[model samples]
Target: MNSIVTLNDTNCPITTSLAIAEGVGNPHASVIKVIRQNIADFEEFGNIGFEIQNSISGAGRPTEYAILNEQQSALLLTYFRNNDTVKAFKKALIKAFFEMRDELNKRQAPAENLSRMDILQLAMQSEEERLRLEQEKLKLEHQIEEEAPRVAFAKQVEAAPDAISVAQAAKVIGTGQRRLFAFLRQIGWISRRNEPYQTKIESGYLDVKLGSWDHPDHGLKQSVTALVTGKGLSKLQKLWSERDQDHAA
Candidate 1:
């Protein structure tokens, strides 16, 4: 292991530099021997400006050193088989060493349980299921909204005027029975009747009056011509006829 190998200052740690070169998969007697050998070699090659190179072959010029053992005639290896960050550094150095030097043939690759395709398929399926559930939830929410108003109207109808029919109330309000009830409920003018047979309007005893069309407060105005025209004009015609009869008398 007293080989004259190139390394960088970052990877110059004795244990790490050795651990990387051998790709020690598991802590073994052989791995420890390699670490000790590299550390001894580095101490021997004191600052001769060793060339620094990258782990990858395509990487640029040597940024570090690979100072070998100058004093020791033979290198003694040190073992670093652990799971800590320090151990990880050693592992990376070993991987880089084997890759850069084309020494992978000497070691076995690490074990992996999941394949690339299996992981990809699982990710895609998870996304699809999520989208489908979201769409279904949106559909159910829409249905509930559409039926809300109709359900509210039906409840109002059940609690209508007891003495006066819904039609009578509609006539007083100058609107259809259903439309009038909907408007009453919408405006919060009524509530569910507590009495067994009483309607909401009867229970609340709300006034169903259509005030004068001529009143400004009512916000209704009849044109002068319309007031004296059509069926409305019949009352005026009788009054005029009575006036004519009185003049003849």
Candidate 2:
């Protein structure tokens, strides 16, 4: 018996019912009757069955032939219980299906210039890169959480004095002078000014103490610097902690 099965236009391996009958050494009419009897079973199995195709009969008259795909052929084999030939035919049909599927895959793969093995290697590499990127993203998120200033600053804020200097506040908050100033501006506590600390003091966000100091090059000069109030410190701490929590979430 010829084991070669031709693929349809869609590159699916198919064999006619007449071919299946010939393979199983059964009459065409008998095979067709059995298929019709258990059609409901085939329909339940995702409608894997046959389609009628025009064929010339032995008497030179045009008749219908049932064209079955791999799935349909396998399904039909279940009816021929204890039949060794049917079992062998099923195996051959399965092998042909796999061959046709692989051929279709090669034909449909992108980059026709590349060999199948090369394409598979590229696919594996692409998957590896995707996984690597995902892992890196998770690691970066963990690092950001671990290094957040809110964790340490929350503790510092609880132990802070009633009032602290801008420098002291910066140190407690784990930030640089420039970054602290920027944060103050962002929070609307201070605007563009020659004396931002003094402005903050006037805005009631800080307490100011006036004093005089002697400079190396200059005579006694009036110096002014503001201290962050207890309330202001609490507010800033809450803001940072909430922001950190939001990012973590």
Candidate 3:
């Protein structure tokens, strides 16, 4: 798992409203509502940045979410009723923000000692690195454009009945079904029999459903079909993306 907080483009440590919702086990809209209701109080710490992200659902609608700095995020927590889950998330979030800020501080520590020529050299190096990043960004944007059709299809084929079969998940993830099953098995998320491990089930990443089919002459046969929940699907997507990055590297 990654840190719950992240550094934003402005080099500020921030956490999103969505992450807060997921961590606190509250609906995203409810979290957004709280932010909106208490906007003035939060702004007292700093100006909150509101942005829109496209929905991954079939509707393809955009939703508004807020980005909050450490103080604002900590303050927002006071509006929620205290609970074990909320308290735990708050602790984790605060730790993450502290760690990120410490990292930023460490990165800036060498600036005071730089000579004029060292600063000039660093500026040139930074420009070269920025150009390289721009090229990579363009490539990434092109890749996203190419995958738009598949992503659209995935949204249309939403996971149903609270979960989806491995085959269905493969379609949503834009991978071959057999390949996905193999990957899952190799990662120990599933068994050789293609069933999710008991631990994964407990983690709410997967589930099992009893299924039956008519046998040729022996009558009916029963089987357990391993299923992937929405959470599991997102996890798999992230893992697959990391795997691709590793392969590319």
Candidate 4:
């Protein structure tokens, strides 16, 4: 195998070099000495002192360690610019850099590694499974369609209106007598007219505007605060914000 394949690149040579310098502790060290030390550190310890913080939250101590604040990090970046010894150390860490990065990633979210081809294969498998499910769904839909007419006819007779006879109410509702009675009774609209053609109408109970079917409101009406929370409240807040922005704009 090519040794270069196992090497890190020199993208952040300055930082790498400073790490070496910091570890070995010599401001005026030779480039080769710094490089050797950093490489030896990698070979021996498998990583620099940087610790990755664990992402998953539980009772465990954080998995990755953090080092250096903004000032220290900035200094490290600047050190790479004027320091040849640091550059050499960075060059030596190139191979291990990628491996270290992968390890850190796995520690954060473990999963099997996948090549491009492997990902493509899995995607294709998912597509095939989805298509199979769709075909089965379509076949089931066809079966439902074949049985629908008879089922509908039976239901229609059962649910036919019992309140006022449709023929008598036709003129008042501006529809045909037969059709009007059928419609009104099915919807539970009683006649206003009294017995012996009393023509008394019962009040309509269904609120069609709320939803598709005759679903009753059922309980006491409440304030908006009771209905919204978390994401729902967030969405309402966003809508109000957008409205305000529009007015401002």
lDDT score of model 2? 0.62
All candidates' TM-scores?
Answer: 0.20, 0.39, 0.46, 0.21
Model 1: per-residue Cα lDDT at residue 142? 65
| Ten-residue region with minimum lDDT total, candidate 3 | 149-158
**Per-residue alpha-carbon lDDT of candidate 3 for residues 75-194, written as tens digits (9 for 90 to 100):** 878878999999999889878887897877765768778878888887897577677767965775564444332232221212236789999999998999999999998787877667
lDDT of 2 at 143: 44
lDDT of each: 0.38, 0.62, 0.76, 0.35
Write one digit per residue (lDDT tens) for candidate 4, span 131-187. Answer: 776786577556434433212221111211332332433343345655533433443
Candidate 4 yields a Cα-based lDDT of: 0.35
What is the TM-score of candidate 4? Answer: 0.21
**Deviation (Å) of 126 in candidate 2:** 29
Candidate 3 lDDT: 0.76
In candidate 1, which residue ranges exceed 4 Å CA deviation?
Answer: 1-112, 151-249
* Cα lDDT of model 2 by residue, 124-196, tens digit: 9767766776796577556434333212221121222477776777777776667776777677565444133
Q: Cα deviation in Å at residue 157, candidate 2? A: 92
Rank candidates, lDDT, best first. Answer: 3, 2, 1, 4
Q: Compose the digit string of candidate 1's lDDT tens values, residues 1-249.
A: 323233233324232323334443544334334434465454555532322233367443222323333222123223343556546554455554455445323222232544677666656865776677679657745643433322222122222223354455456545576664454444344333211111322234432322236666767653210001122123323544565588799
Ranked candidates (TM-score, high to low): 3, 2, 4, 1
Question: Which portions of model 2 miss their true places by more than 4 Å?
Answer: 1-4, 46-61, 115-249
Weakest lDDT window of 10 consecutive positions for candidate 1:
223-232
> Which candidate should be chosen as best, given TM-score against the real structure?
3
